[model samples]
Target: MVVSTRAGAERSQNITVVRQAPPMSRTVSAAGLGAVGGMVTEYLFDPELGRSRRARLRDKGVRLTHGVRNGTRTVVRDVRNRGQGVLGAARYRTTGREADDEVLHERVRAELGRHVRHPREVDVRVESGHVTLTGDVLDRESRRAHRAVARIPGVAGVDASWTTHHDARRAPRSREDGGPMEALQDLFRQRWSPAGRSLTGLAAAVVWSLSGRLPRPLGYLVRAGCAVLAARAATNLPLRRLTGIGAGRDAIDVGDSISVAAPAEEVWPVLSDYGLFARWMPDVLDVRRSDDGGRSQWRVSGPAGVPIRFEAVETAREEGRRIAWKTTEGQLVAHSGELSVTPEDAGRSRIQVRLTYNPAFGAVGHAVAKIFGADPGRKFAKDLMRLKSLIETRRAPVGAGAGPRE
Candidate 1:
């Protein structure tokens, strides 16, 4: 009796322990969520660029909200249009009144293109709702053309006088002739095409559902695939372009233009003097040009006072007009820049600068830099403003300091 009682007690204890296991899982999940939240907070509230990053996040949120609203409206409109088309089709079938001969001819002609391989070769004529088709057509295509014309809302009869050839090679080819893959590619490229929408929607749904059910690395991969499909559906950009691959991936371009009060000739000296770039260019600490003036080395201050160094060769030069340079091969970061000065009215000049840089990590590095307030585009705009002030006022701007320019 005692042994039986002890065994019963142990069994109850085991049951209680098993029942408690789920809470531990719940606790671990909560901790993971807390860690994620802490990391996000640290990222957005960094000491140096927190305010700007937060502002950017807020702006992006607003834009995303607007996009969602607009997308909803578009979907609703599409559904309404489809419903109207169905109703119109039904109404046309139910009506008994005979359509005019000219109207019936236009309808048959319109329907013929969808069914026939070579619509232009087939001539169409309609008299009292009777459609007459006369042309050289393939034997495989003639029956379909007759049936399609006869099915039109007001088509009474179809008279096919076409010379049917058994061999398709001898018949006239269609303007849209292509292989199956070509057709699919064309359909996928369209932003809001039915096929594209259906495929992306199905893919997104399947992957999203599987992402939660899958485990660890597999789940992560599925989530990434879902994101890529969603983005492709929204933007209609090719995978190569979206992922920053292929030929143009080496050139991430940013540009800005500013007007200066001085003449083009005066501005030319300020721009052409590579040695004095540190004075007006933000973050540039030193510039050293080769004896031939065809090559130059630059030292720039990066985020957290990290030193960035690169060598560039002068690719193009036109006196008082334009200067272009590109980084030497085998560099970690590929960089190229162009500056142009154009004469404007009232003795003014317009200076335009274009810079292209492909970082070591591609688009992801660029995005991270932008988020941390290290965007070269914004820096160049500030540099242009400082240069404009220095040239027009004949001295440094009000808050110019000895350290690297902000």
Candidate 2:
């Protein structure tokens, strides 16, 4: 039997106070205090408990304890020490909690896959809630992977220190997984429809008529200018219908345009505001953008309010000019689209959205497509009109850092 001190001397007690060595106690660390019936199992103590340290411990459920490590006594005082920056190098160490190991691993991998291009090649390990992402990633992909995992809910922290850059040959493909030439070829082929051909012919005729009135050298210059303009227009015109998938050959091609009173600089922020887009855009429930601003996953409410989800990656972007994205995970929604912001005047800009997606429910979908017309132009026009209304009136939905308009 063990006798206790003070008034409880008559009762027997079993208590073990495990003290760690001094050399290992430079920073704050938590240790198990051994269970004594109803007593706490973990005791976290450090000698210099600054404001930041105390806040970290308090936030993480740590308490103060009067103790000694290796014969050096520790002070147990109020955690009100001041004159310290909040950005101090104060790391809180701990023994991980009881979490489902399998669940943690699955979640980590899923989040990584959603953000990284080649998740199969990446290695992930999870103990309790702490995760380690170690693999060879392409340039800039490693940082994005780290940021993506860190945003997950149950993730306590991610240790990406071991992540390395792969050589060019072995590097993983980016979210935009196709070669530049292939993308360009696809673009040209998609724009080679009957209507596109008609428009190109009309443009050529107009250019020829205007150039014939100019001097010999000026006429040649005019022809060259028209050729450049035609190429640019073909790419900007977003009217491509890829066969097979969605409504099969009867897939939906959507195009819409709106003129906002504000310039692209003011309007670009609203378009990129993924978190609040659902509030303004029709049928969308939420959008989650990955780090590096190159990829995103969208969750939308579908028929009967059922949630439909898809992942997309940015293929190309030109600041204040045009941005294009294509679906990488085409399980639910196979689509590709582009948005262009053209300056109309000093203070106004025109925003155009060209999207082509497969509503893949073959038979019933084809019937529905016939009912809704060959293209989703009307629905898209309505969507863009809503955006124009919101931006022009400065009445965007509530989002982070959004306040009353000036």
- Most TM-score-accurate candidate: 1
lDDT of 2 at 275: 74
lDDT of each: 0.76, 0.61
- Residue-level lDDT tens digits of model 2 in 1-406: 2333553653334556788767645433433322332242122334454555657667655333322231122111111121132223122112223347677788778776655556766788887788987765666567767887776666788998544555535555334362211123322653444344435646876987789889999999989767654643433333322223333223556677788889889888776566756656657777899988888988876665677898888898887688888888535777788888877886999898887666645333534665655335555665677678778877753441222111
TM-score (C-alpha) between model 1 and the true structure: 0.56
For model 1, what is the alpha-carbon lDDT of residue 111? 73
Tens-digit lDDT string for candidate 1 (104-193): 877877776776666777888888877788887777777877887788887778889878878756766534462111123534563455
Question: Model 2, which residues run further than 4 Å from truth?
Answer: 1-250, 361-367, 370-375, 397-406
Candidate 2 positional error at 196, Å: 18
Model 1: CA > 4 A from native = 1-202, 211-222, 230-251, 398-406
TM-score of 2: 0.36
